[model samples]
Target chain A: MKELQDRIRIDGQVIGTQTLKVDSFLNHQIDPAFIMRMGETLADKFTQDGVTKILTVESSGIAVAMAAGLKLGVPVVFAKKKPAVTQDSETYLADVFSFTRKEAVQISVAAKFLVKDDVILIIDDFLAHGEALNGMVSIVRQSGAKLAGAGIVIEKRFQEGGKKLRAAGIRIETLAAIEYMEPGTIRFAQN
Target chain B: MKELQDRIRIDGQVIGTQTLKVDSFLNHQIDPAFIMRMGETLADKFTQDGVTKILTVESSGIAVAMAAGLKLGVPVVFAKKKPAVTQDSETYLADVFSFTRKEAVQISVAAKFLVKDDVILIIDDFLAHGEALNGMVSIVRQSGAKLAGAGIVIEKRFQEGGKKLRAAGIRIETLAAIEYMEPGTIRFAQN
Candidate 1:
């Protein structure tokens, strides 16, 4: 976690007030070594939960999901956000609001992949508004899979997403929580 | 590769004449153990390429890319297909034609992750019409990075994609190349 914090300070770009762009290593262009380390961390955190599957959203969350999936030795299922209307074919669907795009979109996982009586661990790169997490949670609930909890690489403490989840009694663990960010300065949450 | 061939026969579904849906283990719902084996096989195949990075498109390819990235200890850069107009930054862009979707879409990668001197190995789930490979090739070329060839889990030999890449003098290695598939029967290329 200290290494991740250090990486955030050195490589992370504070974009505007809310967004921290880590495309250099986390999302778009992945640091395979760093991601593997992060995956191990997540696995260590959730190893005792009996997690059978790891769920995440497509595009950005795929790499981190993959890393954790490999370490946890669990099948990783990523919900796809298709822009066009896909003919509903036995998929667990949920509508999620993306704060970045400021739009509500549907995300889905095939019913065949997620089954009842399986423990699901949800992992993602960023947890800001928690809309994506909520969507994944909805899917897990629909599938009747037990939610092991959510593991996040970085969480924006200033955002209501993390707070809301914790308030709902959902166990949430974040490696690095950003308190605030200014033009040339950034702050971390007190451990 | 025998394990992969056995998996194809047992778990893979042949839909129509061309589409061999291995979604049960390869793409949608991954078999963690089999995937790790596939990753090891890819590592063995590309050990001599001196690959510095692993490149692939989003969604399906992310799992295999992460697998290879873990083994090679190199970063994986995934090209994102943006359904909406992405915020224009200095990103490497390429137009890819999807054979399944039958449409051309724009995919982009941040310019920072891919440098000019990097040697990249492309990883993907399926190699068919080679449109995805060609699109990735365009991105690698745009980045001025050398393509160390591709590692495909399953290549449809009936499709022109594999043939085209080999004809273009790019090194391609597929764990299981399907020569033909009938109802409930799949044939692999004799290695």
Candidate 2:
């Protein structure tokens, strides 16, 4: 976790007072070794939770989720994002609004993947407004699966997402929690 | 490779005569350990090529690319797909048409990720018509990077993509090459 924070401090670019661009390593251009390390750190937190599946959204979350799934020895299911809703009885659908893209996308997982006996662990690249995280949780609930908790690579602590989700009794573990960010500075929340 | 063929024969769902749905293990839901094995096999073929980076498109391609990147000890860069073209000078873009979805997507890689000195190995989940693979090849050429070749998990040998790319002097290594497929049967091309 300390290494992640240090890496973020070195490579992360803070935009205005809100956005942090980590595309250099985390999302777009990925450092595979570092991502595996981050995944191990996250999987270490939920090792005892009997997680049967690791859930994440498409695109950005796939790499981290794959790494974590490898470490956890579980199948990783990525919810596919569709621009428009498609009626399907064999899938579980959840609507997520992206604050960055300013678009509403429907994320769906096939019904056969998640079941009541499965324990799900949700993982994502970032937790800002928790829109994507909440959407994944909704799908898990729809499947009647037990929630083990959520693992995040980076969490914006200044935002209300972490607070609101934590208050809802959903256990969340973040490798790097940014307390605040300014145009060239970032502060991490103390563990 | 035999194990991959076996797995495909067992789990792959053949839709009509052309489509092989491998969402159970390769795309929608991923078996992490199996994917890592597939990546190792792919990377093994290019171990002598001095691959500096692994490239793939987002969503379905990210997991396999991550696994391959870890094995090759290189960075993995996933080209982001945009429904519509955006004006960005810092990116290299290529238009890809999806035969399955019947849509045109612009896949872009950041200019900073691929350089002339970098040797790229493109990895992907499937190679039907090679639209995505061609898009990646275009981006790699745009950056003036040397391409080692492509590693495809499954290649439709009956399709023209593999033959066309190979005819263009590109080396392709496929774990499972399907010669043909019917509703409930699949035949792998002899290695």
Candidate 3:
């Protein structure tokens, strides 16, 4: 986690007071080795939860989820923003509003992937407004699967997403928790 | 490669005559460990090529690219189907027509990720008409990077993409090359 924080400080670009661009290593252009380390840290937290599957919403979450899934030795299922031609008709759907894109999109996972006997760990690249996290949670609930928790790479602590999700009794863990940010400065939340 | 062909035959769902859905492990729902094996196989094929970076498009390709990058000990850069808010303004772009989605989409990579000195190996989940492959090849060329070649998990050999790209002097290696497919059968192309 410390390594992730250090890397974020070194490579993350702060735009305005809200956006942090980690495109160099996290979101767009990924550092696979670094991400694998982050994923191991996340998977370590939920190793004893009997997680049968790792769930995430694409396109950013896929890399982290894949790494975590490999670490946890479980299958990774990514919710699609739009159903592809090969997508199954039966699916659990959730609506997510993206603050960055300024749009609402539906994310869905095929029904066959998640079942009542499954224990799901939701993973993603960032947790800000919690729309995407909440959407995955909703889908997990719909499938009647036991929720292990959520593992996030980065969380905006200044935002209410983490607080609200914690208040709702959902266990959430983040590698880097950003307290606040300016055009050139980023502050991390102290434990 | 045999394992991949065997897995495809067991898990892939052939739709009509042209589509084979391996969503159970390759795309929608991914088996990370299995993909890591496929990645190793792909990476093995190009181990002597001095691949400096692994490139792919986002969503489906991220998992395999991450795996391949990890195996190759290189950074993986995924092209965004649509530029995100954090995306760089300066980019190398190309238009790709999706046979499955039935629409054309522009994929772009941040110019900083690919440089003239970088040797790129494009990785993807599927190659049908070479639209996506061609798009990434174009981006790599735009950046003036030397291309090692492409590593695809599956190639629809019945289609013209593989032949066309090979004819153009691009080295392509596929784990499973499907010669043809029907509602319940898939035949692999013999080397």
Docking class of 3: high
In candidate 3, what are the lDDT values of residues B1-191, reduced to their tens digit? Answer: 89888998889888899888888998899999999998888999999999999999988888989989998999999999987776677899999998888899999998999999999999999999999999999999999999999999999998889899999999999988999899878889885
Best prediction by DockQ: 3
lDDT of each: 0.84, 0.90, 0.92
**TM-score for each of the candidates:** 0.94, 0.97, 0.98
Pairs of colliding residues, candidate 3: none
**DockQ, candidate no. 2:** 0.69
Q: Give the docking tier of candidate 1.
A: medium
C-alpha RMSD over true interface residues, each candidate: 2.4, 2.4, 0.8
| DockQ, cand. 3 | 0.91
**Residue-wise C-alpha lDDT for candidate 1, range B34-77, written one tens digit per residue:** 78678768877988888999998987887778778888889888
Ranking by lDDT: 3, 2, 1
Q: Which rank order by TM-score, best down to worst?
A: 3, 2, 1
lDDT of 3 at A79: 94
B152: Cα error in model 2, Å: 0.3
How displaced is residue A182 in candidate 3, in Å? 0.9
Local accuracy of candidate 3 as per-residue lDDT tens digits, A90-151: 89999999888999999999999999999999999999999999999999999999999999
- RMSD to the true structure for each prediction, in A, is 2.1, 1.9, 0.9
RMSD of 2: 1.9
